[model samples]
Target: MPINADYKYIAAEIEFQKAETGAQKMKALRNMLSTAPTHKGAERLRADIKRRIAQLKDEIVKTKKQGKGRSFAIKREGAAQIVFIGLPNSGKSTLLSKLSSKKIKVADYEFTTTKPEVASIKFENIWLQAIEVPAVHEGYAEHKQGRQFLAIVRSADFVVVVVKEFRDIAKIQAELKKANILLRKTKEMIRFEQHMPHMVITWKDFNKKNLVRELWKAQHKIRVQTRAGHKIAPKPIVLQEGATVETVAKTIHKDMIRKFRFAKVRGPSAAFKDQQVGLEHVLKDTDIVEVFMK
Candidate 1:
């Protein structure tokens, strides 16, 4: 198809090129398409612009559905939510099935998995959830589903960039960067600093140890088992080391602190076996605590 010679369309094309986010580029494209002359030269441009707009709308809808707490079901509830992203047929499905018990469809073809699939994986004692999303490819960002898929990626606690070959890595990485979901380390990756608060990278590689040791430094976690039940919840509750029993109660439930009386403890944080401690007692990792309201 021949290109449009209109200057207004040219300006819109420039705006689209300068746009950072997919949404922005899409909007620019729409504006440019409308101003473009309906000459034979701009025939393909109109179709391309319409397709781009539709894709952008779809992406916006997908992201909103996930964010609005609707059918997306990709919410973060466990210790952390890890998402796997890569080009189609890049072994993401295989890796997800290997890491998690959840059964997700995998095929040798492209675009087998279209929606986000959730599964739980164990990291030592910690339980981290994994989400597998649609495969991304060239012009994927131009697809509405592609943008929608990125919305899902944004909510992840950590990101796994799947790659079958080495060269393909750069393409996915650059795409992620444009969406503000950086894969590279920023200031917040630092654990010892304790002062840098604004770390914005959305995706990270999975650690072999199973445990996301990086998440630990971000939020010190401990398993608080109910003495009555003799075990902690599926995932450990996140808290600071100095946080007390009352603090944990508040975390588990808002009314827990008010209904709380005294708690018994066993494990590293306690001084004695089944020690009767007050609400202010500090907790430690793997601490077994029983709260009594009655």
Candidate 2:
């Protein structure tokens, strides 16, 4: 049976997915646990939430004990956060510098990058934040710094596994798996097909543009432009796929949801010019929404 989750639970889930820090994730998870349905069918869901909450608490404690004023946290920016992860000497920094157009230090030695290096890469009309995390190795999840690094990966919207050879992909994947980071192929985004469960792109065919496109598609998001009168907003509001008119209203203003009267739509989602839609109406990319308040 379906969980039939309510709006509060769904909103909490969105917050959890976008949370950048352990504290933020903890808050979202707590909200999810509180708002989740208290039905027999949802017992497993509740248990899973409780288990994750406990795990996060332990991780937070371990991180605090390990760090004495050091932090691995990178502030998320732009449309999305794409993390570049791999084993040592995997050319992660090379890809990061090329894509972001930033002068990042590139070296031949192992573990050259000791910390997280971040920059922004534009994808057509929007820009995305890209981060090259310190390399992963065997028993990485057990190490103090490695734990912090994996935390960053967990918060990323998309992950690109960089490697010098195709075989090295397995090594990186194994290390990431130890940290509970799962990688899956998004066939819809790119045409490359691999035997592994993770999305592994060939280094020969991979370039700055391809990386940007893959990140955009893997994010599973849509850009919606909210309109006022005859003028539309200069920047579109980024939201997850399947976002509805109610979702847009809440994003614009919390009160907009409560005081919602109706909304007028145009662009891709609308069936007719300036069509009237209710809160449940799903929005599409480039859709223009004009919300009316009671």
Go through the candidates in order and give each one's C-alpha lDDT: 0.65, 0.77
- With a 3 Å backbone cut-off (N, CA, C), the pairs that clash in candidate 1 are 55-144, 59-148, 159-204
lDDT of 2 by residue, 1-294 (tens): 122555566557656766778889999999989988898878988898899999999999998998756487577767887778888887778878878879889888998998888888988767899888888889888888888988887777767777778888777767767777655546443211221222455568576777678678777788887776666666677899999999987775465677788999998889998899999999987798887766
The segments of candidate 2 whose C-alpha lies over 4 angstroms from its true place after superposition are 1-70, 182-198
The 10-residue segment of model 2 with minimum total lDDT is 189-198
Best by lDDT: 2
Best by TM-score: 2
Q: For candidate 2, what is the total of clashing residue pairs?
A: 0
Give per-residue CA lDDT, model 1, range 182-271, as digits (tens).
Answer: 555454441112222212222254443433444444444565555444444443454556878887666543445666668888889878
